[model samples]
Target: MNERITPASDPSTWGRALDEAVNILSRGGLVVVPTDTVYGIAADAFTPPAVQALLDAKGRGRQMPPPVLIASVQTLDGLATGVPAGARALAEAFWPGGLTLIVRAHPSLAWDLGETHGTVALRVPDHETALALLARTGPLAVSSANTTGSPAAVTAQDAYDQLGDSVALYLDAGEAPGQVSSSIVDATGETLRLVRAGAISLERLNEVTPVEGPTA
Candidate 1:
């Protein structure tokens, strides 16, 4: 059975919530959580067993690598190596919000982050409760909280209705703030390019990246 957690920016019971979330994560349990954009199901990034469980819960294949969420941009260096200037620029621009940056994995930390060949997608969510949870749990492997090919969850009820007994915890911080997912860009090469476009506009992305490339 999963527990329903009401999230708050300045949570009166944040300490308790954090304790529960951390314990669940450390024990490799799946957690359905809210982000600045959409609701995501998270597990410990370092645990392959937990990752496979998350993929099974979402009905997603290995091809759809889950993005990792960390407490702060400072933690990026610990996961990925030589983050490019453009990548850093965007993180500075839209971090602690809805933007996923793909970067090369550090050789030493490579085994834990899973199969990206050599790259990993990372984000720092803009929600206070989410960040607070991440700060304690370290990096978590997260993806939209829904079955593969289904409409992503935008509320705690949406998550519960779909994920039901699959997850260990359902953090219902009300509805997803943006009602959409983060715009993703692969910064693995010389140029930053779009992998998925949702909330953040391409016009806005151009402001950060050079305006010359095919829009995927």
Candidate 2:
């Protein structure tokens, strides 16, 4: 059975909810959690089966790999290798918000997030509940909590309606601030390239580092 949790409740209640969500994730189960941008379906990134389950829930293929959400900017060094100067600049300027940096994945790590081509997209959301959960669960393979080609869920109910019982836990923190995803920048290249334009504008990204035109 699926469970709905309100992370905005009292401290003790919120703590329990976090525990439950963490427990589910530790067991290779999926959860629908709120981010600064939108609700996301998340699973343990290190567990290939769990990651695969997230893809199955979204009815998506390996070609579209899910990004990893982290609790802190410091975690980036552990997950990614060859972090460019532009990536660090962007993270310092826009992390804990809506900016995702795609960098080369650390070769030492053992996990499959599907067709990443040796790269991993990572982000640290600005939401308190998301950060709190990430603090406990570490990195999660997270994608917008909706079927492929559908509108991203801005509320937990919307996520539940689409994901149903496939998600073990739903942390309902009310509506998300934005309906858009994060601005994706490819940091693995010699020069930063805008992969997807969203909350963060191209002009803002260029202020920190030179950004090439949008990808084809």
Candidate 3:
């Protein structure tokens, strides 16, 4: 259970920190990273063992799989399929913020995300440190950096306290914004469905494209 913590707050340290984080992801390791909404535990999306380790660290089984974080909004098509026009509109408007789009997984992808039911949830985070890591690591399977039913980690220390040595490294970029988690939408079907409401409101979402909630 060996672990390392790297401070990524300083601009000068970003180069070194990102390099180390990239290396860790390359070899199937988990890292606690600061995101716009909260800190998340990340692993290489294409590495089955690493993804499994992430799920294990969070105490969630295959039924609750982690979402994939991408470097850019354009990366969505490469990983997911059957993305409707409405989903694209939403991605264009709220991406790099806190919107998670759940679309059908690309048929050609070789990786296994566990009981995904052919769907993959994807987002492009707004935080600089998280984006820098994603730019180098491509897509990472990431989830809230806390155990099941626990408060989401808002800092690297919060994550380390719960995850302990299960993670290979913790990228400390100071406290996360800690406002709200990303809003999720299910776009695999004909109509867009609101899976979870968080930072982005349903009203704001409908401004871009119509969305259905429980009431709908």
Clashes of 1: 0
Runs with alpha carbons beyond 4 Å of true place in candidate 1: 1-10, 110-114, 211-216
| lDDT at residue 36 of model 2 (Cα atoms) | 93
Model 3 clash pairs are none
TM-score of each candidate? Answer: 0.92, 0.96, 0.96
Model 3 lDDT tens row, 89-195: 99999889899999999989988888999999999999989998888888999999999999999988888999999998899888888457999999988899998
Q: Provide the clashing-pair count of each candidate structure.
A: 0, 0, 0
Tens-place lDDT digits, model 2, residues 1-216: 234645553455588788888999999999898899999999999999999999999999999999999998999999998899888999989989999999999999989999999999999999988898999899999999999989999988899889888898899878998779999999887889998999999999889889886958
- Model 2: lDDT to the true structure: 0.91
143, model 1: CA deviation in Å? Answer: 0.5
Predicted structure 1: lDDT: 0.83
Number of the candidate with higher TM-score, 1 or 2: 2
CA deviation > 4 Å runs, candidate 3: 1-3
Regions of model 2 farther than 4 Å from truth: 1-12
Specify the highest-lDDT model's number.
2
Output the better candidate (2/3) by lDDT.
2
Taken over the whole model, the C-alpha lDDT of each candidate is: 0.83, 0.91, 0.90
